[model samples]
Target: MIRTGTEYRDSIRDGREVYVNGEKVRDVATHPMFKPLVDIRARIHDMAHDPATRDVMTVTQNGQTNAIGNALPYTQADWWAKRRATDTVLDAVGGIVTRVGDETVGEMWSLLDGAEALAAIDPQFAPNIKAHIAKVLQADPFHVSANTDPKGDRSKAPQDQDPDMLLHVVKETDAGIIVRGAKYETAAAYANQAFTKPTIANWGDAALSDYAVGFICDLGAPGLKFICRTGFATRAQAEDYPLSNRFDEVDTLVIFDNVLIPWENVLFYRHTQAAMHIRATLHRYSAFAFVQRSLKLADMLIGAALFNVRQTGLDKLQPVQEKLAQLAVWRESLNAHLTAAIVLGERSPAGLMMPNQSLLYAGRVLACGQLHEMMHIARDLCGGQISLTPDAASFRHPDTAPWLEKYYTINDEWGAEDRRKLLAFARDLLNSDYAGHRLSFQMFAQSPPFAHLSAVYRNFDWDGPLSLVKDAAGLSDRVLGAKTLTPGDSSLSKWFATETPKGKAAK
Candidate 1:
């Protein structure tokens, strides 16, 4: 049965062990910090039921319907079609939910599909993954994927890091394998059903035997503890903090205290090279989806920024118009890369059609830098109004009405109340913790701009261009090796050394 939003909520009502700040969260469904995020997740669930969105948000699985999301089967083009529908749902939500932090986990699951691709190499692994996917599809389960191992020193390998820093297999038994240590910055673990696949990013020869290990376990599984950080969301009231209220997706550090993963749930153990391959491939997929989402977000922000300019009567200002033009360029760049990726997508071995890695990586690099520029332009266009605007309560206050009406009212066309609401909406974006989080998110969304650029440079086909350049330079094997000078280069070099003029002659 396809779970509705209410059903998804009720499913979490059962007491599950989750710790936040040294205290166990008695109920995630009711917790103030978690509830709003759950509300967002519920909305996603509700989308599956909505007549308008249902077709796009749910998919039929083995004799059952599952919420179409990052986890939808993509083992074929038909699967890709379903995923495109899922993309439609995500785009409808805008950055309101999925582009938020926890949505990172959803994107991770899309990449996890690659693991299923790897399972095809071994029949034993294939069946285990298929079963897990089927079980999760039936319940519409949420999973948090941990890919980064906490290394005390950046230069050191996972094995060199305090074993407690990286999750490692400590004991193997007939029943399961015991893993200990912690994975850092795990988003949405508090509200998720399970955390799957803690794999090492980089490995060495000594680390080869323990290279990559992938498995799944429930959030309440014996030894897992969640340590959450206090953020803008956890500290503010819903009315006073609209941004935090709507979008405080919490990130946590999940410590596995000898957590046991049943043998059946173990997808890969000690296959280090395959593990790195999976991580890199997942990065490509997640980055592609993330860029797609970010472009949509940029579009929304651009609209809001333009609206702010028009609302404030600054639309005619040349400087403001120039800024808007720049924003349009940024938006176009983002969309172009996304469209390129889509058109150039290829079928993965796992049957999932994935975006071109080079384009996706390039898009992420552009987004990281361009988002900051766009935000700055938005702030500039809004001027001091974004920071100086009063809160929502001030508008409702009785005594301030006369003064607000006289001063805040800009054009006679827009009344005081209209102006106040516009300012409030703008403040909700500019002054809220959401703004701070967005800045942080954009800054660190990918590994790094340079890192992404490096990946793109590595993956791009430089050989084709190199061949063209070499041939143009008359350095190709056909000419250079045969000691023959190409006419173009030889003539150009000779002409450069000796300039001839009709009037000046030989001089």
Candidate 2:
């Protein structure tokens, strides 16, 4: 079932502890710093009920209506529908938002894929995951992800340093497990829940440990505290920093001070093998939504840069055309990977449709690894005026209005006020404080660059290339003993072997 925007706003008014900029937020929905994202999230909820977009945003299955984002993907069409729903949300919000429910909800699906392995350790884990997945559809809560603990003193173990440095089960009560520590989570100040899990680390050879725990954290739980980073929305005037004022998704360090995670919420506990499984495949499905953000970001970069150059008549230059082509190449590369992944979607052990791992991970590497460079190219195309432009107030001031107008106006087609607005937009999109922060956010949003490469290594078809080289070298049959090597069977063949519904591209 879908909720109205008002219901979502009221849900976060649970009086949970939330602080930012040395001030405690009395109401996240009304706070200036948090209101921007809260409002966008609310609008997203409303979008599902709007007649214009309701069809794209909701799906009916088994005679029950649910948010498309919460529906489990089973067919190739299901993935396409998911992609379309996310696009509809982004289009309505007018910017990229990475941590909304659609992206983080998939983490549970990944765990669903590993249910058998997790159930081996604890019989209750599998059913718990399925139940929570159902709850996501039924309750329509705003979900987020929680990883990346404070993890102080890497050189020392949790026992050697502060035990609370990494989130661990402090004790187990009859009702639930009490956990203490903190996690760096984006949008936790207002989001409903988070899939709290272990970060990627060296989990030494141990049968069981308190640190290897994963659960669904209710953000409004009694002992929870949200210590948030300063949001950009209130940092400056909205007129000059449009993107920052509207699209800044405030991040927070959520302190779990003996917070209670109910037993039913526990996805895995005291199982290092399950923790390892989670780390290995955490982004298996979620990365589709994450990388989709970069594609929109690419469009933003291209649109901002193209508009700037076209205004100044630089679009006529061949050099300018080459730079624009470079941006398009990056944009299309992401599109290709996302499209190919759906066309060759594979069926998971849980019977859900998964994007082709090799293509999806490879696309993630391209989208994240080269984001800053693309931003830089866009910044270069916007030219130095983006940095030197005066504040919007100067153009409106009576003392300087005439002077600014005379110099800023290029022709009748490009008026002074229009020029001022474009430069201000370019500044925020490329040179502002928010731009820098978002660049860093994109780079490590999923994990690190090294981890991206590791995923590609694990998923890429090495055997195809290996067999090609061995055959070219005239290797004997005994060399590959007992293993049949198809010399040039493409990776697509293996992915298509899975019994998933054929995507339109495949048919």
TM-score of each: 0.83, 0.97
Against the true structure, whose TM-score is highest? 2
Which residue pairs clash within candidate 2? none
Best by lDDT: 2
- lDDT per residue for candidate 2 within 19-99, as digits (tens), equals 999999999999999898899889989999999999999999999999999889988889899899998899888888877
Query: For model 2, where is the 10-residue window of minimal lDDT?
Result: 498-507
Worst 10 residues of 1 by lDDT: 498-507
TM-score of 1: 0.83
Off by over 4 Å in 1: 21-23, 60-64, 70-95, 99-126, 155-161, 185-187, 193-195, 198-202, 207-211, 237-240, 477-507
Q: What's the lDDT for candidate 1?
A: 0.63
Q: What is the lDDT of residue 224 in candidate 2?
A: 94
Which digits, one per residue and each the tens of the lDDT, describe model 1 over residues 1-507?
Answer: 566668767776655556676577887777766776777777777777889988777666566666655454343343345447646755664444443322443333443566655665444564666666666666666555665555567587766767666678888898988888776543444444543554435566643454367776666576777777654565754454566666666767777888888988877777665565555555656675567667766776677788778877789999889999998888888778776565555456555566656776778888877777787787777667767866667767889877877887777787777766655555656656677777676666555556667778766655445455677775756633454443434322333445443311211
Error of 2 at 387 (Å): 0.4
